[model samples]
Target chain A: MEMITSAQNSKVKNANKLKKKRDRDKTGQALIEGYHLIEEAYQSTVKIKQLFVVDVERLDEELMTYAEEVFEINLKVAESLSGTVTPQGFFAVIEKPVPETTQAKQVLLVDCIQDPGNLGTLIRTADAAGLDLIVLEKGTADPYQDKVLRASQGSVFHIPIITQELSEFIDHFEGNVYGTALENALPYQQIPSQDNFALLLGNEGEGVNADLLNKTTQNLTIPIYGKAESLNVAIAGSIVMYHLKG
Target chain B: MEMITSAQNSKVKNANKLKKKRDRDKTGQALIEGYHLIEEAYQSTVKIKQLFVVDVERLDEELMTYAEEVFEINLKVAESLSGTVTPQGFFAVIEKPVPETTQAKQVLLVDCIQDPGNLGTLIRTADAAGLDLIVLEKGTADPYQDKVLRASQGSVFHIPIITQELSEFIDHFEGNVYGTALENALPYQQIPSQDNFALLLGNEGEGVNADLLNKTTQNLTIPIYGKAESLNVAIAGSIVMYHLKG
Candidate 1:
């Protein structure tokens, strides 16, 4: 076991910089925080590079045993690496899983989801709905961001998320790709379920980009029955995902 | 129209304090920010007590005409009253709607949802799913908080929200009351659709308090297919809400 007492420790500073997208991309690693997330990672067999605990005595024995390297850090140092208001006393630096090429039956294609929370929620929902693969386009928010990770509630570790040009993926995809849009689209429930399909959810403000929408096999809309102008993208996406699941 | 320049202006100071629950309850008013929220409030027939705008020229004519009192405030004053990171140059102080007791077909009873964002999302989903009324218990997050408002995306203006004791409300309620729980609960999908029901969602951590859960007609759980411990409360509630809709 190692001990890190200073907030200015090089490792602590480096972990803090993982908050940025560029740093995460460069290192191909991201920080996972809180007991729930760390537990999920260990149980899922996600490779954890290092684990830092604010209170080693309070850490779970299983997690301590599973971690590749465990370090006891001062509270101040632990807090410096956490993005949450209340640090959960556990943090891990894990290698971003290299997503395998998937020919999965059910797929979710996320297009330009900007809000970290919404994107994370979509990931969690997809996982629960038993979607096999999630493909993110360039404009989508980083799934590895701390807020996104927290919002995903550790489903990110359980699901396979890969980033690629959505157009290329759609072109190569052998299944029906349904894009959600408000205009000239059949109600989602009207779209009969099939064996395998890809659902494309759009940006918060903008519907799926024109190019992608043009390429999708069909467009779908979740009926809104109230005075709300539109449903939140994440909610709409999740509802449609569940409704269309085979 | 009156022009207010100083951040310390009496009206400005008072509105800023409304961020606190005590002040909001004392005044029976809450601050609504952003162009979209202001627009929603104006169009939803939600009474606007005062409208404060950074640029009168940019203010929509109908909103200015509809407000009981409209003030043109300087940029600094607008920023001072804003709870968001980016002020959208529109602010309004609106009287909270006095919800009418409803015996509608579909209803949602929120027990003690602690996250402002989750509570707001649930409200929005309930509205979108066309549930008639939302009853909040004492310990739920304040919907008037800026974060909840933002997350709701103005659905707060469209929905009827009332706070009551869960036990009391359930005792007098005419509909089937379903509580969500993880233990010994039937799958939500297995619960047959009903014409009228009250779905009760509990605290984020503790779940529906044991007392309330014990009182429900039946408990429901959304099955998780992935290794993720559980679905987000809001998402789970929304999924069930939509599924069980009459």
Candidate 2:
């Protein structure tokens, strides 16, 4: 039942600060932009810090009743705080999700999927496939990024996504680790599988990290026959995820 | 070489007009933003109407030599003309590429791919697959869209892309059309010869249009052992492209 009238308000200032990845990481806060993203995040039960409604007159009472704290900003200030040009007039600052450190059942790991859209889509697909957890290595883009979050459409909220050292967790589980590579790899379908597994996706250019590759139990590829140097990294990852499903 | 200082200058106005699809379609010349895309258009021997450059003093001579008419704009104008924030400092008001009408040896017919990223990636993939032509039916996004252009990385310039009356072209080809679907279609790997083919990609939500599906010489589905609902459109197209290769 609070309204933040000034962009200079301490809450607005702190909310705006979450735009940077460093800030999000340091403070354990994530920024979800636009009406749809925030709605998805809400539906997924991400803990909210504060809500900023640009035009209070237009907001329905149903949405207003859900927020713990609400603030109103002029369109300009809302746009200033928003990353996208077409601001949705509403935004939220929410706490970062802490995924459970579970024993691997089935996992999709992204090495360095750089394209945010692709990365988010990959995560969404992984979640939709009923995979237990998603792991991101050191160089991968932040899964909490605004664009990635928006592209994910709130899967980031519910999905147990973790970023950790690859070597730290390499030998900790008892499942096969199948990574995609261009050469000396079997076709994805040809690789026989058991129930417990982890499928690794390499970076767009360099592919799976060398350390992880050396430890991988199986190496596989899509059996590409055309002239494409390689398929898009996200597409490759999605295919592997689909192929590896138990 | 003329420097356009005022945003209101007539040519500057025309150049700026290209920022939106309505303007682009109205003028028959589209704004190809970013250095790589302009480079792609220029390298392809396509005619350039007006080459808009910014920070001209910083450009290399190779790029400088390719422009027919050049104008200098500030970063703001360049940003306005570009759809993305990181303006490439160079944009081209170029004629839409029309590839030779030579009978297509193999064609790709796409139906209602709504995502620009997906459509652009498909176009780029089609080019990589050595496809002879690309056909976009109604409900397809503009191929000249900035996101598609960037995602395609200029492959559109080389590929013969057509957005036209689907029935007429499908009628003329008389080649076997393979439409992708969920079930009841032959596994892609079992398909016959590669030459004289048209591959149909449909909407992600709706699958192929019924009219086009009826017209398909055959219906095919990629063999999937996984539980994922469907492969990403670009990946699905690539998998089929790989399988259909002779």
Candidate 3:
């Protein structure tokens, strides 16, 4: 395997930047970590920029077939390139091309959920519900961030994603927009889950803003039976997607 | 605000332990940061071993009433006490009391979810669904660990949680047991989501072990309509909880 000891190596420096949200934002690229995540990136048919595989001999022959260019790096070298402890012994630098968000027949809108893991999972759930696009309004975590990408399991590659001015985008689509609220809203299941709908979710701490709520066609809430103040944003979004689909 | 800067100080040392999973496990304590999370911990009526508010005057009057013993720690002191990014000017040392896990007719069994955030969200969802109790088998992330505790948002304090051998616990649970899977499982919505049934979940990556599959009375999966290979495990668990409750 080729040795990469110098932390100053250009590739190493770029991979490390992915750990922070700001660098990820400025570069418009994400570092995909772990074997499965990188595999999913390839399987999604997203263009691969560079693949850094540690212990290259251990990689399955099938995965190697998809690599445009593969770099063999030792575990120590990979660790220097990792954002997490126990780096999956490998990572990839994928150019984050803004996805081609299709015309919204049915869509999903996410307010600034802030937590990287939560946002990623919401995108995964949205893709599963067969929603057309995910719009990341202000205050949301970087979807292309390494943690968010890993949480999404490469669904970001397949799903159409757009992060832009929310009000302008919502005004353009104007379909049946439903937002989840804690109280004073009809039960999501009771509301009759719709097909061509854009499910909007707000930040974990605050529900959607009044201005945004005024824009929604309807305000809906998942009934909470127990003592919990609310559900995790990701879980809430997923449950809403399921009920609204059926 | 009382400023204590020495890392060797008793409180500072205790809070620093929270950064490591091992120390948090050994002490049976989690150092919760931020006014919002700490306030939620109090509002939930969870017992706190100690309250470390960085700015006492900044706290809402309602919250100040709850801290029986509030220590005002300075920002520099708070930074050394903080487990995460620039301390939110607040911290708390909460005794991770093991909840009294009642043997009910139903429960949620976690096999081995490794992500602390996912585990915490699951516990929160379990509480929301009004499940009987939560049982975490070995290999699961420690529920009392700081990250999981934060994610639970005091739901850990509200719910009855237990950790033990999976095979042994399921062997005695006296109701219908369902596990999440891909092919063999019933559709989540199709099954009669029972309030008195136990739900089982597996590791995020490897999934449920083959041997454990025999122990479950039934297997269920949230049907995916789009391109994702699988839904996030925590979402999968929460969706099943909602369906079972319905």
Candidate 4:
């Protein structure tokens, strides 16, 4: 274990750069904060590159045992390195896992979901529904964003998330792609259950992209019964994902 | 129309105090920001007590005609009074509607849901599912909190949300009360559909209070298919609500 007291330390500065999407992409390393998330990541195959801590006493033996390297940093440095309002004394830099091809039939393909919280919730929901994979199009919010990680409740560590262009994914995917949209869509209940299917969702404001929607085998809609114009994107996605998990 | 330049004006000071829970409760009035929410409130039966705007030109004729009173304030004053990071130039003080007895068959009972965004999302989901009402237990986040309102996306204006003790609500409610928990609960799919039912959701950390759970007609669980510990409270509530909306 190394003690890092200075915020100006070269390692600390480099690790902090993982906060940006470009840096994370370039290095294939993302920072996961909080004791819980770090512990989850520690249990996963994703390699932990480094661990930073304000106090080692707060960490469990399992995390310490699994960690590749540990650094004890001062509170000032910890605060500067932290992303959340309440820092939980531990952060891990983990190598982003290589995107794995999905073998299972049920999948969720998300297109242009810009909200971090929505994207995180969708990932968590997909995990809970027993879906095999979640495919994100290029325009979706970064899954590595701190708010996304926090909102996901550590599901990011569990779920297999892959990012690629929606058009290519839809064309290459083996299952029937069911797109979600408001107009010219069958009520979600009316769509016949399939043994192999992919659920596609879109941005918060716009429905699924027109060209993408046309490419899907069918489009589905969750009926809004009350004065509410529509359900929040995450909630709508969850409702549909759970219903179609059959 | 009234033009107020001073933030220290008596009405402005009184309106500002509504930001606090105690003051909102005492006054039975809460501020709703943004053109969309204000417009929703204007269309609803709920009385608008006062409307504040930095730009009179942005106010629609219908809103101006419907508002009980309108105040034009300086941009500096508007910014100072705004709750959101990006203020939408319009704010309204709306009288809290009196709690009415629910007439429909479906209801949602939330117990001690502490996250404002979760509570709001749950309410919005309930609205989308055509639930008759939302009963918030005392420990739940205040429905009128700015974050809650923003998260609800104006559903709060449409949904009938009432606060009362959970014990009393369960005892008096006409429909079957279905509680959600992780253990010793039937998978939500296995639970029989009810003609009239209330879905009960609990806090983020602790599940439903045991005493309240005991009083419920049945306990339901959404099975976790992956390594994720659990779904976000709002997402979990939504899946159950939509599934059981039979």
Candidate achieving the largest TM-score: 4
**Would you give me the overall lDDT of model 4?**
0.85
DockQ of 4: 0.81
| lDDT scores of the candidates, listed in order | 0.86, 0.76, 0.79, 0.85
Model 4 residue B17 lDDT score: 88
Instruction: For model 2, name the residue pairs that clash.
Output: A4-A71, A202-A207, A202-A208
DockQ of each: 0.65, 0.22, 0.63, 0.81
Cα displacement (Å) at residue A106, model 4: 1.5
lDDT (tens digit, per residue) of candidate 2 on A112-171: 788788888787677655678888898788888887876665667656888887666667
Error of 1 at A99 (Å): 2.0
What is candidate 2's CAPRI-style docking category based on DockQ?
Answer: incorrect
lDDT per residue as tens, model 3, B66-117: 6555677767777787667866868777766667656675588999999998
Q: What TM-score do all the candidates reach, one by one?
A: 0.95, 0.75, 0.84, 0.97
Q: Please tell me the interface RMSD, in Å, for model 2.
A: 5.1
Error of 2 at A239 (Å): 2.7
Poorest lDDT segment (10 consecutive residues) of candidate 2 chain A: A222-231
**Candidate that scores best on lDDT:** 1
Which runs of model 2 end up more than 4 angstroms from their true locations?
A54-67, A70-77, A181-196, A218-229, B1-96, B102-107, B112-115, B170-246
- How many angstroms is residue A18 displaced in model 1 relative to the true structure, after the best TM-score fit? 2.1
lDDT of 4 by residue, B1-49 (tens): 7898988888788878888999999999998888888877777767888
DockQ of candidate 2 is 0.22
